[model samples]
Target chain A: MSEPTPHSMSETTSTTDDDETQRSTAADPADPAASADPTPVPGETGGKFGRYGGQYVPEALMPAIEELTDAYQRYVLENEDGFMDEFRRRLREFGGRPTPLQHAERLSERYDRDVYLKREDLLHGGAHKLNNALGQVLLAKYMGKDRVIAETGAGQHGTATAMAAAHLDMPCEVYMGERDINRQRPNVFRMTLNGATVTPVTAGRGTLKEAISETMRDWAGSVEDTHYVIGSVVGPHPFPAMVRDFQSVVSEEARRQAIETIGELPTDVVACAGGGSNTMGSFAAFLDDETVSLHAVEAGGADLSIDEEAGVAPNSASLYAGEEGVLHGARTKLLQDAHGQIVESHSVSAGLDYAGVGPELAHLVDEGRVIPVAVDDDHALEAFHLLSRTEGIIPALESAHAIAYLEAGTDTEAGTDSEAAGDDGGEPDAAADDSLGETVVVTVSGRGDKDLESVIEETAARDIDGAPDMSAFTEGI
Target chain B: MSNRAVSDRSGNSEAIAQAFADGPAYIPYLAVGDPDYESSLEYVEALERGGADLIELGLPFSEPIAEGPTIQGAVVRALEGGMTPDRFFEFVEDLDVDVPLVCMTYYNLIYQWGETEGPRPFVERAAEAGLEGFVVPDLPAEEADPLREACDEFGLDLVFIVAPTTEGDRLDRIMDRVSGYVYVQARLGTTGAQDDVSDQTAASLDRLREYDVPKAVGFGISAGDHAERIVAGGADGIIVGSALVDIVAEGVESNRSTAAVADRLEAISRELVAGAERGSRARSTGDPS
Candidate 1:
């Protein structure tokens, strides 16, 4: 069972029983052990994932957050106006849900284990971002909101939110860091084509952190008519629990598919974690299964160290090297300095270039229920090439972090995955992991179409062992 | 764990209360080390010289979500000037102003200040730095227990902002944790200068009638007339931020001397204070702005 929050923020439901959630969903008729929905029961944890989550926002946002919290309880939890039912239907018809769980035959042979790919990459808009975006946009409509706003890092969430907004005919605006807009130009084009105005955030490092702050500033002013659909499960209250509920369909379906295909739950479930929507979603249903080992891979940009004088961290591995701190509305593991100022995080993949992770994921890591691993840019790049050549699928750079973990166990030059996954506050190279077992399921979080430019540019700069011949394409293709 | 390092929390709160006891409390805010450390210190001193009551020294966090471009720009300048939490405390200690000073920043800086865990370490350090209280924009009362406990232990006051939308049970919850003066948001948005006074101010102030805390209005109180209107609408005090910082930004942009910038701030502070006093007299005489 999930632990109680250190401080519960429930005045309305404080008198209610802690065991009974304000609203509980009907159990899936399938495996009862896979129903580990940690959508913080109000009055029990409020919005906390232990000591990490709360509504750490300005007073101006309290009304909106409370309204959203109520709407979350009604529309999302109780399925009022058939909101969730409609959301699920849209996922199947519009977002292309129940994406295939393909057995990577070649990858299985290479890893000497049965490797299954939970294909979120095949979802419409080329990523798993649509699940939450579509749900939140729909929730906004149910709550009488006329407009939507969001933040994006790699532009996947931006594109997905833009697409959902267009589908629902709601005016949409997406705030993206200026650097990310320049790097992820194709995705920017996608958002604009879907009729969403893209606002470039020119603050602080011009990355996800800046974009989120900008979006929040906009929401603070326009919250009466507009809903800020947070891109990940990192923000205040209801967003984390609500987004997890929306995205948990990933693990729900993956678990059922694994049972149908391989007769039981996979021994390991791996996914790359940035703000941890996909990671939490993929692990939510498997959390109750004692035998299932969950692995969350993080981007290790260049190295694991930070430049104190420069206030810049070389990597985005918060779980690997972070202290407990509040960032982006929640207290979670963050890449910060001796002083509390958040350091700029780096990663070759724009999606994983964030200083904080999901509060729930941090709690799970602290509980020793989730294994956190880091894959440096070089290894992630190599894994990108390896997956494309071996599986004929060019994975997004974020997903390549997970793909790299598989190789870390076998790749001689690359470090072992076991050693990287250990967060015992010791040397990272001193851990052991011999229980990856037979069947492993890795969620391919997104397609690499938006990453083609980054891939070509990065591959040309480095000597990736299995990268395609780039002599003809190196001259700015 | 130790109160020896902390000044009496009531001493600062009493100072704040004493400031309010005389006339309309003129609270001015500026991010510490906006352009440079030396200039920021001068600017704060100028506020005190201009009849300021309590002062808010912004400890710039890397990400200030509640700030508009004006204050965001100020934060950017302060951060670029190498303003860390340690530097902020040092800057606070350096301020020679007589008014009780409070630190306004995000919760991250408070939660991660000291070598040990939790807000106690930060609160102890803040109390030692001669700060009276804090005005963290991001910390709502729901997540304020730890910080509240820390402030109580340190004898510092914990302030909460009550926006126009706050009401009923939620308002009660916030009011319970509020000490020092409550920051009454004059409008429904982030901190910035605006053309007209918000009509929502009267209703918000009226809702807090039952709460005995001092109501200091802020947000969009750019000019002296704005301050007058807010105080006339029944606020115990008036708080101004971005408009003053805009002058600082202009000074930095025009490459003006510190004296010139600080002189401009002092003039505006006097205007705001005079206007608030006029409103206070008008309130007693039953006149509207």
Candidate 2:
């Protein structure tokens, strides 16, 4: 009954990393997250950590990406003290950093498992997207790029990019897919109000790919004068690498706090994956530690059985239906056909709507260092509501996918309706104790403010229906 | 087979089909993601009304490679207006402009769609939605047969291009098998305003005429003057791209206030049409042609 006291909700999945620092000044020990690993990070500038974060761009855009890399390096090198001080200051004051490590007391008691959350939702911009956007925009300013261009899927990146650009007083342009524009209208309006030009792409299937293509086109046309700020850890070299480096703040903090609070490292690390930002950010530091199991849960919209979207089927399944090929200028697993043509990608979370993962994460997944799991939209929704009801914390729909994986415990049947309510109409609480296993920690990446309407509609519908319909929706193909 | 017929309902099918039969090369270009789909309908209607002789509707891919800044800005606007292949087809279907709507698009999109997998379903879907032809900017004349075959089966024109950089044997081959007018790249660049119409372009037109094809010069023929000079230089048709894209730009810039910008664009289009008509008349007479 007293097994580590089931880990206080705040101490469920602790990550205890060594405090040793790299000897080289090219490495910063004050930035403990970036200091944990001693391996060659991966790419040319930093260790690409598996080919995930190389600079894969057109020949014309290389100079721009390199310029950004160089500027970031120069800023980090010359103004280390100033930059880190400002980074930490703004992150705390402006970005609302050091978001609390909240213990889910009620959930821990109800499920008989310690469930703690690293609440990133408390960050400004309502998600973890700002972590990198702020870093990159500041780097762009340091690089002397007068303007920035970016692509958005559900408009989270667009809004974040616009916000960062506005704060920096740099002009911003966002390329969005036509479909995403309609689906995420409010974000579009928000970006426009923020003084960013919203260019709707009217080609192919109006989705993330179109948004990415248009971003590339815009960058190609203006690579000389603009910085193309990518949203996630995907894209070719440097981008996947750079975004992770910036977002690594999440894991860095998580690892430090885990040791400081729990006196050890966590047994497991879990986060959601759209373009795999939070997951990568949460797991990058712990990658080489063979003891910690890193889990990345992808959206399984309605049917957990299916690997892709229903109506608009795509060929990409970097984790499930992809092969190792080059796409968007980097060599990673691509969801392309034999001939290398891109196929549509599907995920419940707008942020995870990409067909590929960050190259570094892909390498880790390929090497079996990290475990990959898919959670359908319906279950993710359940996790979303569960976290809200249990902890009074509403997480981003994207982050909910990861929570679903932790709550469901890798067995699709574990979180089923029959398990929740029981076959003979027994009380729902009867199976609660049986379901709880180990200390479960979920990364609440961002606030659900952006997804509040959708969550309300989903929960309202579920309340009206009396139960979550398992058949009508489950994470599937 | 003169490019003088003007009827919104009819793009003078008999003349265009005859021109195809005579091996008259054609180059038709329109901003793919054009004036609002509503305005694109009008521009397509105008091309039909002006007897474009052979129509090329730019596919308005999210990434347009052959556009200058003016056309590029309009494309950005069209994309903003929810322009997708499905919506574009819907616009084409509703427009009721009966002409060979050759879809001028970039390569990556078609490649993404797996052109070899018979993008015909998409093309047929568009054709069913009332489109008639395709001219992907990146589809070289050498690899044009499959697209040509798909169009041929559907009674559509699979048009090809002859850039200024196109050489002798390739030129002769493109001229020989090209069905719709051979898309004559008037300049060494994308579709937009040019400083001046080159004399070398005139020489290229003459060289093309020697192949006995009705050649149409495209890329940057914007104003009435440019149209007149093109028609005077032995061009049977003057295809306008960014000029049309500019009208679209004007309409979008005015918060999409249709009437004023549409009227202004209509007038410029009419002048170019009239200028082309006059040049055609002069050439027929061999007097001031």
Ten-residue region with minimum lDDT total, candidate 2 chain B:
B1-10
TM-score of chain B of each: 0.96, 0.82
lDDT of 1 by residue, A1-477 (tens): 132211121222233233222222332233222222345543332577666677788888888988999999999889888998999999999988899999999988887778999999999988999999999999999999999999999999999999999999999999999999999999999999999999999999899999999999998888899999999999888888888888988888887788778876687888999999999889887665545677888888898988888999999999877778888778789998888888999999999999999888887777667778788999899999999999999899999988888876444354344223222322233012433557889999998989888888899899989789776776857
Worst lDDT 10-window in candidate 1 chain B: B1-10
Worst 10 residues of 1 chain A by lDDT: A1-10
* Candidate 1: residue A171 Cα off by (Å): 0.8
Q: Model 1: how far is A286 from its true place, Å?
A: 0.7
Docking model 2 quality class: incorrect
Q: What is the lDDT of residue B26 in candidate 1?
A: 92
Instruction: Give model 1's docking category.
Output: medium
Please write out the lDDT profile of model 1 over residues B152-207, one tens digit for every residue. 87778888899899998888888778888899988877899888878899999999
Candidate 2 deviant stretches above 4 angstroms: A1-59, A76-85, A109-112, A185-195, A202-205, A303-311, A314-318, A324-326, A336-341, A410-437, A460-477, B1-289
